[model samples]
Target: MKIYNTLSGRKEEFAPADGKTVKMYVCGVTPYAPAHVGHAMSYTFFDAVRRYLEFLGYSVVHVQNFTDIDDKIIERAARAEVDPAKLAERYIAEFYDEMDSLNIRRASLYPRATEELPTIVDMIQGLIDKGYAYPANGDVYFRVRKKDGYGSLARRTLEGMLAGARIEPSSHKEHPMDFALWKGAKKGEPEWPSPWGPGRPGWHIECSAMCHHHLGETIDIHGGGQDLIFPHHENEIAQSESYTGAKPFVRFWMHNGLVQLGEEKMSKSLGILVTVKDALQKFSPDALRLFFLSSYYRSPLKFSEESVEAAERGAQRLRSAASIEGQGTGPDLDSDPYRRRFVEAMDDDFNTPQAIAALFDLARQVNRAFDEGRRFDEAQSTLRELAEVLGLTLRGLESGTQADIAPFVDLLVEMRGELRKAKQFELADSIRARLQALGVTVEDTAQGGRWRKG
Candidate 1:
């Protein structure tokens, strides 16, 4: 298998540092607020990557960290009149619900920043003791010039970096390019008692400490959004390697493309952000997963209401086809050939769009099998397996949202249909009104009425 390594700026063959096991870490959210579509896009892509590796028989140990204590979280908590820890925990649970709804597998280790303060302090002390870091006032900053490969990741010259950094003229710093490793806690903010006075770990230092604590000195793959390519990831590489004496902190650096609203990037400041909760009310969790997986992990995907509606329609067709049960004596289920196409497409750098096309072809095969009145058990099994490998729900459980709506919708539709046929127009209108009030949208189509949650 080969993956595009951002560190090397090329697609290189994937060889694990350890035999038969792939150790990976992807930067996770800060949990200041509910997860947005951008966070979902990045995590879902990494989940697919991890799932594919596991499907290929590689024991994958995936680690993603939660930055529980950050400036944003502190600010949000203060505004809400709550403790920062309580606010972080609330959003963390909400994030888990979103991930579970989309069928994302839980990571092997999810180390939170608050839980790993000792590790963070120890790593910073190691860097400072080794002369790669310096304490300024009460805060600790990484000495950027001390690392020979400081600009290797970002590929900027020292003179250019010094000039380019939007640095304030601070009292304590050897250079303007140096970034904080430990931020000294100010009053009215969340903090912990650390060796560097009362403070919290800087954003970049948290990941380095977490990876070292969980995945070890080096990992096979380190992934995050494309925005982290600059100061965040570059600082991680510098601090991690400087402390551990490891040549390469991570062999592969996979950065997912950013999420955009049409031509503009979706961001909190831009006010074009879509939260997962608001999105789930309109599109099924599976539809969101399908929409994200429809693009290559490294390519930017533009998201819009129209695009999501299209994906929802397409995904519904797959689910409808998978629900078909073959009659006795239909097409030969064992003779279908679309599985090979799906596997081959996924093999070529996890080209999910091509893989999705293959799935559609297989769904057509099911249609053909039903039209011919042949057994389609083989096609059904193949579809389920393919969907599972993609971390999609082929056959939803008979619980949760599906279960609650399935029998109720059928009963309500049947009653409404009976009333309409009986010419009791007033009663039929009343039933429709009640259903609509309950958040069920009933639309009359050519064949009959269709119902979905509003």
Candidate 2:
């Protein structure tokens, strides 16, 4: 398979270093707050990548890290008058829930920054011992000039980066372009006992250390959002290779484009984000996945309700086609061509848009065959299998048996009854109409309101 490599700035043939298991590491959240759709977009794409790799008969060992001890977590914890660790744990649990709702597969291991302090300290000391880093004023900074290919991943020279970069002026830093490996302890913040006094690992070093501690000195694939390319991932490359004496820290660098809201990217710092919970409340998990995968992984996607609603409709179409059970025994549909098209599209740097189009085309053929009284059970199975490769569970929002949805239907009916009692006839009628649209019919009797699946 050919996958895009940001390191090489082109698509290249993909193979594990060991020629067996694929060692993958995608950056995880900070756990300062609940995750947003931007997070969903990144993780969902990675999830699909993992699924497709498995489908291609490769075992993938994925390790994602949690930056639990971050400035944002500490600051937010102080505001809430709670311990930072407790706060981080709370949100980490919430993150799991949100990802689960989105049908994202769990990573093989999730290493937290707080739990990996020893490895961080050791790596920092190793960098300093090798003269690639220096300690100044109780903080450690990576010597940018010491690394020969400092900005190779970013495709820029040190001079070019320094020219346009926003260098934070510091007395302890030898150069303005130097980034912190460890920060000095400050009042009212968490600190770890490191070689450079009592301080915490910098934002970039935690990930570097985590990857080394968990995955190894080098991994097959390293992925994150494109926003992290400049200083975050670039520094990761410099320090990791410097510490481990490995030439390439990561074989493939995969970065998904940011999700935009209005003119600005949806970011935690900007407070411009739609939480995954809120989006799932309005749209199905399948719809959200489709919306993300409908766009190329390397291209930025604009957030819109209309787009996701349209994806929901598309998801329903696929679900309906897959659910059809053929009665006549004539000719089995030839699904091999569609499968080949899907595999071909995905093989070309994971072209999910074309792959999704193939699925839709196959769905149309499946429906046509069903209408022609031909046995379509095998074709339907193929549809479901291919959809699973993309992590698309061919199930609607209100999937499962009648018992599972009865509670929600009953609640809606009760709400409609209250609306009718309040003389809000319009809203009550709308709710009834919605229920009918979902194949659930409601009846009003002297006893109360009743609901049944049609």
Candidate 3:
């Protein structure tokens, strides 16, 4: 399989270092608030990538880190008059709900910054011991110039970066480009005992330390949103490479594009956001996954209710076709072509849009089978297998409005079945039509009278 490496600026063949397991690290959230749809989009994409890699026979050990202790979390906690750890835990639980709703696979390890203080402290000390970092007034900063080719990931020279970058005033740092490794804790803020006074790990260092401790000195792939390509990931590279004396801390760098509301990116800091909870309540999981996978991972995706509704309709088409049962009297159905097309598209930089198109094409073929009075069991199973790889759970062709009414629908379906057995064709047909009007579809296949909410 080929993947787009953000570091090399092109698509390259994927080869794990040990030729067996692929170690992947994707940056997680700060847990200051509930996760938004943008977070859903990124995590969903990575989940599919991981699934596809495993589908190709490589064991994937994925690690996603949580920034439980951050300036945002602390500041928000203070505003609400709550302990920062309590606030972080609340939001972290809320994030899990969102991820579970979106069907995101749990990472192999979810190391939190608050839980990795010792490792974070050791990493900072190692940087200082190597002369690549220095301590100043109970704070520590990494010397940016000490790392050669610092801006290679972002593809900008030091002078260019200085012109465009926002230089925050820091009295301890010798240069504006130098970033913090540890910040001295204040009286109210959470702190850990460290060599450089009481302090907490910086945002960038927490990830480096967590990934190194969990995955090893170097990993196969490191992924995050495109917005992190700059100072955040660049700083991670600076510290991780310098601390380990490894030339390339990560072999493959993967980044997904931002999800947009209008012209601006959907971010909590921007104050314009759509929470994942809102989306999950309004749309099905298949619909949300379809909405994001409709576009390439590296391209910015626009958010709209209309778009999600359209995706829902599209997903309904696939589900409806998948629900068809073959009569055993039609022509033979083959799914090999569809499977081949899906793999071909996915192998090229994990092209989900094209892969979904292959699914649609199979759905169309399955529908054609029903029209030709042919059996489509093979096609239906194939559709399920391919969609499973994308982490999309195809809902029952008939999705009911409420879970509490399943028994009631089953009673109605059973009554209709008896009516048909008594040779009451017209009355039974009327019953079927009434059920269909109520969003329940009853199909009397050779197997039995199967019914589901549509």
Candidate 4:
């Protein structure tokens, strides 16, 4: 397999340090509010990475972290009159709900900042003791220039970063690029005992510490949205390598592109939002998952009602083809070619849009074979198997409320067929019209009447 490595700025042959296991860590959310589609796109991209790796016979130990404490979390918690920790807990649960609705596989571990306090404090002190970080007024800041190759991952020199002034000047810091390792505690906020009095870990340090504590000093893969590349991930590289004395903190830095809303990025600060909960209500798990896969993982995905509708229509084609009634008759269709195409597409830096195109190719052949009174179970199963690698489910009803109503629709279609056999035209037509109104297509087949939900 070959994947683009942000660290090297090129697509490189992919393998783990051990050549057997993949230690993958993707940045998780702060959980300050409901997760939006942009968040869905981010996590879903990484989830596909994990799933695709495991499909190739490699053991993948995936760890995603939660920023249980943050300025945003504290501010939002204060506004809601709830404890910051409690607020984090609430949205953390909601994150699971959104991911589950999207059929995202749970990571091996979801370590929270609150739970990894000791690990955070120990790493900060290690940096301080090594002269890479210092304690100032109960706050600890990393000496960015003290660490060689600090901006290598992002491919910027210390002088260039300073010129850009990506980090605002702080009077206590020795340089403009220096970032916090541990923040000083304030009133009415969470804190822990550290070498520098009592304080919490900085936004970037929490991820570095969580990775070391969970994955190890050096990991196979580190992934997040593209927006985190500059300061957030660059800072992670500086502190982690400095603390562990490792040459490369992460083997491959895979950053997925952002999901956009028109001209602007889909972000809370932009005041443009579409919650995953609300999206799940309007679309199926396959539809949403397919919508994301329709675009390359590293390309910006645009959101539109028409685009989502088109994905649902494409999902329906797969569903409709699989639902065609038939019995095994003629020769079994060869599916190996389709499988090879899918694997090849994904193997080339996880080109998911190309892989999805291959899936639809298989789906078309399945439907064509059934039309000839010849069934190919192998072909249908191949389509399902390839879809599984992309974390998409083809056989189920649309997730959420529609999933609950599927059986009833099937039953009513069956009853309506019975009424058609009994020559009850009026009642049969009434049932058919109602099903059509609900976007369910009831087709009369020679085998019997079959139905599909749009």
Name the candidate that leads on TM-score. Answer: 4
For TM-score, candidate 2 versus 3, the one ahead is 3
Task: Give the C-alpha lDDT of model 4.
Answer: 0.88
**Number of the top lDDT candidate:** 2
**Model 2, residue 167: what's the lDDT?**
71
In candidate 2, where is summed lDDT lowest over 10 consecutive residues? 394-403
Model 3, span 1-454: residue lDDT tens: 8999999999999889999999999999999988889999999999999999999999999999889999999999999999999999999999988898788899998999999999999999999999999999988999998899999999987798789757776888888888899999989899999998998888999999998899988999999999999989998999999999886899999999999998789999877889999998888888999999999999999999999999999988888786676545777779899999999999999999999999999999888888788878888899988999999888763344546777887787788888988999999999899988987778886556887766
Off by over 4 Å in 1: 334-336, 395-454
Writing each residue's lDDT as its tens digit, candidate 2 over 1-454 gives 9999998999999999998899999999999988999999999999999999999989999999999998899899999999999999999999999998888999999999989999999999999999999999988999999999889888999889778857768888898889999999898789988767898989999889989988898999999999989889999999999999997899999999999998789998889999999998888899999999999999999999999999988997898788765346778888999999999999999999999999999999899887777877777889999999988997754545546887788899999999999999999999999999988878785557876553
Q: How close is candidate 2 to the true structure, as a TM-score?
A: 0.90
lDDT of 2: 0.91
lDDT of 1 by residue, 346-426 (tens): 777678888888888888878778877788877877887888788878553234545466687878787788787788889
| TM-score leaderboard ranking | 4, 3, 2, 1
- Clash pairs (backbone) in predicted model 4: none
Model 4 C-alpha lDDT per residue in residues 235-341, reported as the tens digit of each score? 99988999999968999999998888887788976668788998888888788889988999888889877899889889888876665557469888888999999
* lDDT for residue 194 in candidate 1, whole number 0-100: 73
Report lDDT per candidate.
0.84, 0.91, 0.90, 0.88
Q: In terms of lDDT, which candidate is stronger, 2 or 3?
A: 2
User: Cα deviation in Å at residue 230, candidate 1?
Assistant: 1.1
lDDT of 3 at 444: 88
Ranking by lDDT: 2, 3, 4, 1
Candidate 3 ranges beyond 4 A from true positions: 397-404, 413-451
**Model 3 clash number:** 3
